[model samples]
Target chain A: MSETTEDIMSATYRALCAHGFADLTMQRIADETDRSKASLHYHYDTKEELLRAFLDYLLDDFESRLACEAADPDERLDTFVEAVFGPAEADDDGDFAVALLEIKARAPFSEPFRDRLVALDARMRETVAAAVRDGIEAGRYAEVDPDDVARFVVTAINGSHVREVALDESPAEARRLVEAYLDRTLDRRSEPEVPV
Target chain B: MSETTEDIMSATYRALCAHGFADLTMQRIADETDRSKASLHYHYDTKEELLRAFLDYLLDDFESRLACEAADPDERLDTFVEAVFGPAEADDDGDFAVALLEIKARAPFSEPFRDRLVALDARMRETVAAAVRDGIEAGRYAEVDPDDVARFVVTAINGSHVREVALDESPAEARRLVEAYLDRTLDRRSEPEVPV
Candidate 1:
C-alpha cells in the first residue's frame, strides 16, 4: 500500500473508533486524514469501497499473523485464542470490536462483506483444526474430532466476542472460559485414568 | 398494548424482517401497516421510539415464554438452549436473527437498548443458574459453580447466534456442540466411577 493509502486507512480506523459505523461518513474520515477528500475519493470512490478495502486490509494482517510457523501445538492454539480474544484490556472499551461488529451486521445485506467474512472464518477454523490435529498426534491432547472441536472453538470465540461487545463483559472471562474448556476437552492431563 | 398499538408493532416486525434495521424507515413501516404515515408518526414519534417498543415487545414475549414453570432441571436447560439457538431451520435464513442482531449491535450507542439487553441477560443468567443449582442439589448434575457455568452458557449461545447470522452457519451444529460440552461438564452420566 502507498503511504497515502496507509494514512487514509489509519484515519478511517480512528474515525470508525470515534464515530462508529452508524455515523461514519466520508467527511468524517477526510477530517481525520491529512489528505484532501478529492485525493481520498480518487483512491476510493465511495465510503463502502473504502470500508471494504479496510476490511480486506484487516483480513490480510490477520492472515499474516497466523501464517508464521509455531513449533508447538500449544503455542499455535494460544496464538489463535489470543488473536481472537485480543488483549484483556482492549475488551474493556471495545472500540475495535464495535467497528468489526458494524461490518458483520452488514454481512446479511452485503454480498461482498458476507463472502469476505466467510473466508476469514474458514481460515481461522483451518488454523485451529490443524493445531488440534497436531496436538492429538503428539500425544499432547485427548482423542476428539479435530474438525468438530475446531468448529466449537470458532463458534465459542465468536460468541464471546458478541458478549464482550454487547454486554461490556470482560474479554478475559471469555478467554479463561474457553481456555478451561479446551483444557478439559483437549489437554492430555485431563484425560481419564486407565483401568487397573 | 392497545389493538392499534399491536397492529403497529406487527407492521414494524414485518417491515424489519423485510428491509432490516439499517434501511428501516417510518414510511416503510407505514407501508406495511393499514395506518397512514401520520398515524405512525403519532404513535411512535420517531423510528427509535418504535424500535424501542418493538424490543420491549420481544422481551415481554420472551419473558412470558420463560415464565411457565418447568419441573425438571434438564427441561429448564433444554428450554434455555432452544430459546437461544432457535429452531434449526430458522438458522438457515435468519430473518428474526438479523433484526435482533441489529438491536444488539446498537446497544453500545443506545441507552434504552443497552438497559433492556442488560435486563434480558440478567433474567437469562438467573434462569440458567437456578437450573444448574437445582441439578446439583438433586444429584443429577456434576458439582460446579452455577454462576460461572451460567455465564459460559450465555456467552456460548451469544457466540453461536453471531456465527449463525454472520456466517450463515447451522445453529444445529452450535446446539449440538454446546449440548455435548454441557453433558461432559455437567451430566451425572459422564461422572467418573468410584473405585470399589
Candidate 2:
C-alpha cells in the first residue's frame, strides 16, 4: 500500500476503534489521519468504498495470520485454534473484534460487506476442513465428513468470538469445551469410553 | 405491559427490521408507529434509554419463548434447540436475527446493553445446566459436568446464531452436529459404538 493508503487504513482502524462502525465517517477517519477530507475523497469517493477496502485489509491480514499451513492436519487445527483463542495473537484483535463485529452486523444490509465477510468465512472453513480431511487421510482423526467437521468447528469458533466480544467470555473456555467434545467425537476407537 | 409501551416496542421492532440498530432513531420509530415524535419522547427521553428498554423487551420475550420448562431434560434440550435452531420458531426471528446481532455488537461499547445480554447468557446456561443435572439424576445421561455441557451447548448455539446471520448458514446444521456430539458424550451406556 502507498503511504497515503497506509495512513488512511490506520486512520480507519483508529476511527473504528474510537467511534465504532455505526458512527464512523470519512471525516472521522480524516481527523484521525490528520489529513484533509479532500485527501480522503481524492482516493475513495465514499465511506462505503473506503470501508470495503478496510475490510479487505483486515481479512487478508487475518487469513494470513490465523490460517497458515502446517505439516500435520492436527498441527493445522491446533494452529487455527491457538491463533483464534489465544488472546492478543492477532495484533490487538481484542480492540478490533467489536469493530469487526459491527461491520458484520451491517453485512445483512450491504452486499459489498456481505460478500467480503462470506469470503472470509468460506476461507476459514476451507482451512479448517482441509485440516480435517488431512487428519482423516493421515489416520490422526476418525473418518468423519471433513466438511461437516470443518463447518462445526468454524461455526463454534465464530460463535465463540461473538460471545467473547459481546458477553466478555474468553474463547479459551470455549476452546477447552470444544476440545473436550472433539476428543470424544473424533475418537478412532471402535468404542468411546463413557466416564463412570 | 401498557398499551403505550407495547406500541413503542412494536414500533422499535419494525424500525429495527427496516433500518437496523445502527440507523435506528426515535423519530424513525415514531414514523413506523404513526405516532408523533413527542409521544416517543414522552416515554423515552433518549434513544439509548429507549433501546435499553427495547433490549429488555426482546430478552424477556426470548426468555419466555426459547427457555421454557420441560418434563424431561432431553426434551428440554430439544426444546431449546428447536427454539433457537428451528427456523422461524421465534416469531419472525429470521428478520430480527441480524438486527439483534447488531444490538449485541454494541454490547461491548454499551454497559446497559452488555448487562442485559450477559443476563440472557446466564439465564440460558442455567436453563441448560438444570436440564443436564436432571438428566443425570434420572439416569438418562452419563456422569458429566452439567455446567460444562451446558456451557458448550450455549457457546455453540451463540456461535451458531452469529454464523447464521453473518454467513447465511443455518443453525439447524449446527444443531445436527452438536446433537451427534452430545449423543456420544452424554451417553449413559458403558460404550459408545462407533460407526466405522
Candidate 3:
C-alpha cells in the first residue's frame, strides 16, 4: 500500500474535505501530512492524480467491506447500511461525516468520481435487490418491487447520514432515526391497509 | 430591503454554492454581482458576516414562504415540506437547499450558523408535530407520537433532496418516496382486514 503515498493521499483528502477543492494545495497537504513538497510531488505527479487515488481508495474500501465478503445477504445489507451511514464511528473520527458530505457535494464536479459513485450505488442496489428477491421467493417478504424497495431502503439509510451530517444531529438522535427507518424497511411483509 | 445589500448577498450565496464556503471571497462575490468589492463591503463588513447574512436570508425566505401565511397548521406542514424539499425551483435560483448543503460542512467551525440551523429545525418540527396532532384529533391520522413522526418526516424530506440532486430524479419519484414515508407513519390508523 506504499505507506508514504497512502499517508500523503489521506492528508490530501482531509485537506480537500476541511478546506475544499478550491483551497487545496500541495503545500497545505504537505504540511498536514508532514511530507516535504518534493517528496509528495515525487510520489504523485498532479493533484488530479491524488484526487483519483482518493476516490479509488474509498471505493475499494467500500467494496471490500460490503461486496467482496461472503455472508447472508440480509445481514450483509444491514451491516453495509450501518457501516456506510451510521454515526457510531463519529466518536473516533473527528469529522469523517463532514468529509463525506463535502465529497458528495464535489461529486457533481468530477465526471470520474460521479461515474464511480453511480456505479457503486448501482452495485449496492443490485445486491439488495437480489436479497429482497430471495426473501420474496422464500416468503420472507411480501410481493413488492425489489428494485424500488431496495432503492428506498438504501436511499433512506444513506439519506439519514446526510441529514445527520448536514444537520449536526446528535449521535443518539441519529441512531433513533436509523432504527425508525429500519423498522419501516423491514416491515415489508405486507402492505398496510392504506395506500402509499 | 436594501437592493444593493440583497444583490451582493444573493451573489455571494450563489458563489458559495457554486464554489464553496472555504473558497468564497468578497471580490469573487462582487464580481458575480457586477459590484465593486468596496460597495459589497459597504453592505457587509466581513466575509463571515456576509455568510451569516446569507444564512439569515435563507431562513427568512423559508419562514416567509412556509411559516407566515398558512392559517391551517396542516397546510403549513405540507407547504413547508413541498417548498423546502420539493423539486428544484422551476427557476435557476438555487435556494436554501444548495446553500444549506454547501455551508453545512463548515458548521463545526461556526457556532452561530450551527445553532441557527438547529433552532430552525426545531421550529419546523414543532410546526409539523402540531399539524400531526391536529390530524389525530380530527381522525385523519392514527394515534402516534407526533414528535417522532415530525422528526422522521423532516429528516426524510431533507435527505431525499441529496439523492434527487445527485440522481436528477423526477418530482414524481420524490412524491412517491414522501408518500411512502407518510403512509408508514400513518399505518396505525388503517383498519385491519378480516380473513375471508
Candidate 4:
C-alpha cells in the first residue's frame, strides 16, 4: 500500500471506531485524513466497502501475530498469549484493545463485521486448542478437554483486554493477571515437578 | 413512575443503546416511544439532562437488582453475580450492556460520564471485594488479594455478557460455560483428600 493509502485507511479506521458506523461519512473520513472528497471517493467508492476492507485488514493483522513461529507447542502458545496480553507496539503505549472493542460493539449492526469477528475468534480458539492438545500429549498439561479448555482460555484472554482497559492497569500488570488466571485454571504448575 | 413516563424512559434507554451516543436524538427517542418531541421535552428539559438522568436511572436499576438480601456474604456475592448474568427482563434484552459500552467509548470526550462510569465500577468492585474477603475469613476461599480478585471477577462477569451475546449457543449452554469458568477460577469445588 502507498503511504497515503495507509494514512487514509488509518484515518478511516479511527473515524469508524470513534464516530461509529452510523456516524461515519465519506466527508468525515476525508476531513480526518486531510484528503479531498475526490481522493477519498476515488479510493473507497462507498463507506460500506471501506469498512469491509478495514475488517479484512484487521483480521489479517491479528492472524499474522497469532500465528506463532515457535516449533515447541508450549513456547508457541505462551508466545501467542504474551503477544496478546503484552503491549501492541513498543513505540505506541496505547493498546489497540479499545479500538477492537469499538469494532466488536458495531458487529451487531453489520453482518460482515460480525462474520469477520466470529471467524477471528474461532481461529484464535483453534490455535489455543491445538497448543493445549499438544501439551497434553507431551505430558506438559493435564488430560482435559482441549476444546473446552480453549474456550475458557480464549474467553480469559479477551476478558483480560477488557479488564486492562477498564482498570487502566499497566500492560505488565495486565499480563501478570492474565498469566495468573491461565496458570490457575490450566494448572500449569501441576505438570511433573520441574525446575524453572 | 407514571406508565407513560416509564415507557418513554425505557424507549430512550433502548435508543441510546441501539444508536451510539453521537447518533442519539430527542426525535428518535420520542418516535421509539410513540411520543412527540414536545412531550419528550415536557418530561426532560434537554438532551444533556436526559442523558444524565438515563445514566442515573440505569445505575439505580442495576443496583436495585444487584443488591443482595442474603445475610451470608458468599450467598450475597452469588446472588449479585446471578442477577448480573441472569436473564434480562421481558422487554429489556441486550440494552444495558450496550449502553455501558457506548458510554465507555465516549468517555474520553466526556469527563462527567467517565467519572460516573469509573465510580460505578469502583462501587461494584467494593461489593465483590467485601464478599470475597468474607469467603476468605470463613475458609471458603483461598487466601488471595481480595481487591485484585474482585477486579478480575467483576471484569469477567461483564465480559461474560459479551460472549453470551456473541455465541450461537442457547442461554442454557452459555450459562453452563460461565458456570464452569466460575467454578474453576473461584475454586467452588470441595477440597480433595490425599490418598491414604
Return the top candidate by DockQ.
2
Backbone clashes in each candidate structure, one number apiece?
1, 1, 0, 0
| Winner of 1 and 4 under DockQ | 1
RMSD of candidate 4 to the truth, in angstroms, is 4.2
Docking quality (DockQ) for each candidate: 0.70, 0.71, 0.39, 0.35
List model 1 lDDT by residue over A37-119, tens digit each. Answer: 88889999999899889888778878867764877888888888877776523433678788778778878878888888998
lDDT (0 to 1) per candidate: 0.82, 0.80, 0.66, 0.69
Give the candidates in order of DockQ, highest first: 2, 1, 3, 4
Error of 1 at A149 (Å): 1.7
Task: List the candidate numbers ranked by TM-score, top first.
Answer: 1, 2, 4, 3
What's the TM for model 2?
0.86
lDDT of 1 at A52: 86
> What is the per-residue lDDT of model 3 for residues A17-107, given as tens digits with 9 covering 90 to 100?
5566546778878888877878878977887677777777777767766753644545655666665654433343536666666666666
Instruction: Determine the iRMS, in angstroms, of model 1.
Output: 1.0
- RMSD of every prediction: 4.0, 4.6, 5.6, 4.2
Compose the digit string of candidate 2's lDDT tens values, residues A40-159: 999999998999999898787767677555577666777877766766534565777788888777777788988898998888888878877877887778788888877777777887
Q: Compute each candidate's TM-score over C-alphas.
A: 0.89, 0.86, 0.79, 0.81
Worst 10 residues of 3 chain B by lDDT: B87-96
TM-score preference between candidates 3 and 4, better one? 4
By TM-score, the best candidate is 1
Better candidate by DockQ, 2 or 3: 2
For candidate 4 chain A, the 10 contiguous residues with the lowest summed lDDT are A89-98
Instruction: Tell me the RMSD of model 1 versus the true structure.
Output: 4.0
* lDDT over C-alpha atoms for residue A12 of model 4: 72
Cα error, residue B27 of model 3, in Å, equals: 3.7
